[model samples]
Target: MADLVYYVAVTLDGYIADSDHKLDWLMAFPLGDDATPYDDFYRTVGAVIMGAETYSWILENSPEAWPYANVPAFIVTHRSLSIPEGKNITLVQGAASMVAAQARMAAKGKDVWLVGGGKTAALFAEADELQRLFITQIPVVIGAGIPLLPVSKVLNLKPVTQKVLKSGAVELVCDVVVG
Candidate 1:
């Protein structure tokens, strides 16, 4: 069995993006030699699960050549969507449990990655489906925007690893202690 890891980048104030769904602040923080985490993740993770909004944001912001070209991705969306040809993108609707199940099945022997959108991550977090959270906090404050984690009763996490980069970015890898 593989664990579900939510690896995402966030601002100092815990915002993943601004109110307009713009990652301009995040754009300023370069990934310089920071591909190690993502590379390792893609290597170990067989599938990715993301919300429709996050998927749309990627499609709108990402390069012409999709980043997750080889790995399978499940996009949870309410509206109809089409997966680009030759790309391993699947569309699913309804609840988070169903999508998480689908992602687990698709993951095979490798881990499952819960990518992007604070609400989507919160769903898995609330359900106690997510095991780990790898957050690379960029040094910037968006003031107000989409939070890195949705408002909830209470959530606890214990740090497992930490790393500081030359760009002043800090990465915290923690295990979720769901109650």
Candidate 2:
């Protein structure tokens, strides 16, 4: 049994990416010692999951190589897209719970990482599949952009830990309270 963690970085305004869906704003900030925390978290992830938009962004940005080639990558999308050859990637369509179950199985004993694009994460949260949220709050504020979690329903979270990184980013880890 592995926990499905929505580990992501968000701006002060609660946006994950800017209005253009660009992470350039986020890339501008240096992680400094914060890199260690991310490195430590990444080590616990056995499988990665992301929405179609996130997958497309990665394809366009890092065309040369797949970043999560070592782990099983699952992309949830309704549209047809071609995956790079020799990459450990799978295109899946359907409900969030189904997709999450697949990722959990692939993760084995390790945790499943719910990689970005707010709608996807919201779907999992709505389905009661998401277990944990590890949010790194960047100091900058983006006026308008993709929200962190765009759920209409209220989801209670219990704080697990909080830390202020060297780069001025505040990391907050919480457990998603489920009924």
- The prediction achieving the highest lDDT against the true structure is 2
> In model 1, which residue pairs have backbone atoms overlapping below 3 Å?
none
What is candidate 2's lDDT per residue for 77-147, written digit by digit as tens? 88998999898899999988889889989998999999978999999999999999999899998799999
Each candidate structure's TM-score, on Cα atoms with residue i matched to residue i, is: 0.90, 0.96
Q: Report the alpha-carbon TM-score of model 1 versus the true structure.
A: 0.90
Candidate 1: residue 74 lDDT (0-100):
90
Q: Please, what are the lDDT tens digits per residue for candidate 1 over residues 1-179?
A: 77889888899998988999998888767867853456676798888988989988888777498777877899877888767788999888867777888888888978889987899888888888888988989989879999888948577989999988878899898998977
lDDT of each: 0.84, 0.91
Clashing pairs in 2: none
Please, what's the RMSD in Å of model 1? 1.9
